[model samples]
Target: MMSYQKFARDVGFIGIVQILTSLSSFFLLPIITKTLGAYDYGLWAQINITVSLISSLALMGLSMSFVRFLSSETDQNKIQEAVYSILFFVTVSGFLASFILYIFAEPLATFGFKDPEATYFVQAGSLLILVSVVESISLFYFRIFRQIEKYSYFTFFETFGKLLIILILLKMGYGLIGVIAATLIVQGIIFLITLIIIISQIGFIIPRFTYIREYLQFSLPLTPNSLIRWVTESSDRYMVTYFLGLGSVGVYSAACSVGNLIQFFVSPLQLILFPELSKLFDHNKMDEVRIYMSHSLRYFLIIAIPAVFGLSALAKPLLSVLTTQDFISGWFVIPIIALAGLMAGIFQIFVNTMFLIKETKPATYINIVAAVTNVLLNLILIPIPSIGILGAAFSTLVSYCLMAAFCVHISLKHFKLDFYYLDIAKSILSSMAMYFFVSSFTISGILELFEAAGVGTIVYLIAMFLIGGFTDHEVSLMKKYLFRSKVNPSTK
Candidate 1:
């Protein structure tokens, strides 16, 4: 308990950062959708999806290598070696990835995006992959070192900075390309700043590539895992573009950007969880790992379950208000996508078991199964006139559900943690009550949507308290984490 007290505080702080990050994304969504409308907004979505897929492939799982290998290290020299070796290697690799994407941008825009004229935007957006890989590695350095303040500040800075710049560029009539330029500019600045801060803290060294082999060996299996996971998570947009059109992809992606917000409940927390769990697992503290994973899952469900319910209840009005009337038809997809986000979070927590034990193949194989299922389902479902884009949403939900089930089965074989099912039941019940209360009102605009949500939040909390949803230990920890208070456990 005492050991992870600092870890708890770190989690609390990162939690705030995630909230801000989500809000920034929410704000960005409307600014782009309303400005660019459906067709061009859909093109923007395609560009982002392409960048994400390419960048993840470029990373080669080095970020995870950084976390696993350096999380427990104390020597600054070895840390420097691992960090620079991975960074420099990724620099070369990232350049190659971006180069390929750049050269192929014409064909991609023509065939993949179904937009022949988007070639220039695709070429310009290729730089995003380079900056994304490097920026992610730099941020992971702060994360592995537990520099929570710097980490949180950078996360906030990049998010809001892009928001401000994109707003300005769009206002000045820059359109989709403006958004891309703004992203590249902000991310490049972030990479440079993080690099300077890193070198300042630890004097620079020419990377010796000593640990490169070991790192690659551990990370290579996971590299393909990223590509496969992309299939399950992002390939559906491409499928929609194929079966429908850029305009429909625009409608699908707008709703997706909202539905996927459910993953925010877990992403920031995972940044801390993976590193801290690595430190403990290296020390043979299996029990502590179990406690950390269990509590993390329990609390994630508490917040995420309510989020899924509230978003489903508000999906229609929320879309109509945030985007235009053209996007309202995509609203039903939000709840399906939100439920998928919920399952994906559960899968992420469970899959850590394989990571801890250094068994990567199983996770890779499971993702392959899920990915194939997703693609096949998209082929069958998306082209149907009756299902259309809703088929895409349902397919994603099914894939994520399958992945979560597979992970839970495999994770338990190695190390099973308490899932706190009864508490999960209580959460479901409380969220159901909030759902009913929220759905009673017809929300038209942003203020009313927020008001209903705020009221629903209070109602959920009150219901949780009434139902004894949290343990005394959990309650005390929440208070201390919230207020940053130092209270003696013996007194409690």
Candidate 2:
């Protein structure tokens, strides 16, 4: 079985980096929002999401397939061939996708954004789509080669780079298009930097086209599955745009920004989990895999529930610091979206199990079902006067919860394993206790942040104990870590 303590340690590191990135992003958003205004901010969100969708097509599911291959296969030569093949495919696909998006930039910008000036912004954003694809390819290569330190470096640089450029452009009074252009410029630099790092580590010669062609037989099948996932995840933005306008999208985007902090938890966990889980499967260690998966589910719920609740409770003040006061109107959307994050976390942990078992079509069907549900819900609800953006948030949470439930059900059917439901139940109870404690009092701005946080921790711990989530053994470990104290041999 995977060592629970060591797993937690790795998760802790991932969490730290993700938290730092999210914290920096939180500060960065307000600067952009204040400089750009809601309409312009909404345009940026639209273009970014549009570019993301196109880039997903360019990726063609190679990154995920790469990790899966790397984990399952021990043949060094085969691994090298697969790596080179995916790299070639992504690079070629990136160019093609960028070119196509550029050709249709005008129509996309006009229909994509609520503002007329968004067309000017779209031309600049075309560069972002191009650079973004390159960056994604580079990131996947980084992870496959185990260049995590460099991955962290690129992540921080790419994030801060946009903030720096945005500040420079805003200072020059270049307005909205300037802000969009700044992001593209920063992304290009990051892409170049990533390429330099990868080439230095693994030589610059392109692999033979024949090698990538062979790998495509395996990778291409996953593209539809990936697209379904993206549709479920991103279609809401489009629906919001169609129904509510760009300005409403701006508010929703801001709320999602807060909610994405929870994704920070998921992203890094996936980075560590996928390769490890794949290796475990290859070795036929079903027991170990079950244990690891169970721990991950419980751990994520333990962290995500309280984290989302705290974020939701403190949303107004958090937004005050993250963006401007005007942006605070969307604060209520934070909780709904944060709940979606929690559901997504569960889905992330379980969804790969189906793939591990090679139930690809079933997994695809589940995702497609969820995406269709999200789209239909948005179409029906976005027109309702009082529901608009709030309806979108609710739809995401409901769909995600269903998706997670379906994946878990499929996993149970395939694996003769117990999920430790009692542990999960206890974690839920603890989370609810923490949430009520934090949400009861209202103080304005960042001051209330500490107030809620302090109480939340105390309540969470007490509830965890009361709910019997921890054993004496686990409690002993906590003491050793938190207090640096050695426990005496127990008198049994």
Candidate 3:
């Protein structure tokens, strides 16, 4: 059994890693925007969107299947069987998908970029599909095995390497093609390194196709889920490009990236929670699962609520410093999209119930409904000329809210999770207080922005304390673990 202290420590470590990974992107955004300009940046966004969609399709949901099937298994032969089965399938599918993308690059560019000359970018991005699939499967192996440190190391290396390469290529005046090539090269190198490490650790055995049927049975239902999720998350960028042009897409993408910082906190919890919960459920330890579920939701809100409030409070100033004036209007969508991201995080937690029960069809269905709603709403709202990208943001928020609500309703029918409404209320109140406090300050530059964040964090913590956000027992446990106390604190 994993102790609370150990779990907390793992979550904290991974959270820190995720924050650094996010910071890499945060740091790169300004340079990317300034170097490529709005139209080309939007084209960059479109290329990535295409890659993400193709990669998701090629994955066929096997990554999650790997976690579900292998998280608790101990048989080495069986592990190898599953591993090679997934690798073979993903490799074939990824390459085939990449080839198709490359062959149709012109049409895709015509449709997505409206400039056939940009076909080369699409073709270059196609190479990323195969390398990305390999990287994702390797990372999933790390995750299922609970190799958190290794996972963090490889992820950091990949992000930093890509950043460095892109910087060099951009400085050499390689432009958009330079950025795409950098991603492909960096990911390919990382894939090779990760595959070697995995083989060395597990020892090579020729893959048998024994688990193919089972893996496919488990994964196929999830393919639509992946596609619909893409629609909900990314279709807006395409719509913006179509209606308002690529510059609008660039601005919207930048804003959405800023708002997605909420994921920095929520994603680490997600990374840890799935395997832990899967193991617990496999052992039929429903009580521990319940505890983990409740605490995870409460803790996510504790961090995410304050973050959304803080980011929203400082949106304008933050955008001014991070993006060019051409993209500053993107700030209008940040608050809306940030809240939407929080709701999306909540939906992730709720959907875990479906996974634990091995009932993912409901999740796919829920997302289908949400994705359709998002697309329709965007269609109606974006053409208003007054609403454009803001309409897209609103559509995302509404769709995510619906997704969360539906997932909660469906999941509750199978199992009960303590929603901890009171704790959530406390978090909201604390965030509101932080927002009020931070908004009182006038932020003009990077230093002032940092000061606002520091002050807001302190104020939010105090408010949470005053409102009884943390239990006495949790406080003691935190102190003991943080200070490395030798005392054996009660885990109850």
| Tens-digit lDDT track of model 3 for 1-492 | 677667777888888888788778866887789899888999999999889999999999999899999999999899888887799889999999999999999998898777788898888889989998988998889888988888888888888888899999999999999999899888888888888988998877778889888888888999989899999999999999889999999999989889988877878888889899999999999888888888888888888999999989988887887788999998979999899989998999889999888888899889999999999999999999989999999999999999999998987786678888888899899999999999999877778878889999989978988888877766566567767655445644
- Please, what are the lDDT tens digits per residue for candidate 1 over residues 1-492? 226667767887888888889888878888999999999999999999889998999999988999999989999899999989999999999999999999999999999998889999999999999999999999999999989899999999999999999999999999998999999999999999999999999889999999999999999989999999999999999999998999999999999999999999888779889888898889988899989988889889999999999999999988988899889999999999999999999999999889989999999999999999999999999999999999999999999999999999998887778989999999999999999999998888888988999999988987987899987776666567666876668645
In model 3, pairs of residues that clash are none
Q: Candidate 2: deviation at residue 87, Å? A: 1.9
Residue range with the least summed lDDT across 10 consecutive positions in model 3:
483-492
Rank candidates, TM-score, best first. Answer: 1, 3, 2
TM-score of 3: 0.96
In each prediction, how many residue pairs overlap at the backbone (N, C-alpha, C within less than 3 A)? 0, 0, 0
Error of 2 at 19 (Å): 1.1
Q: List ranges where model 2 is wrong by over 4 Å.
A: 1-6, 72-79, 114-116, 145-147, 447-451, 465-467, 487-492
Which stretches of candidate 3 lie above 4 Å from their native place? 477-492
The lDDT values for all models are 0.91, 0.75, 0.88
Candidate 2 structure lDDT: 0.75
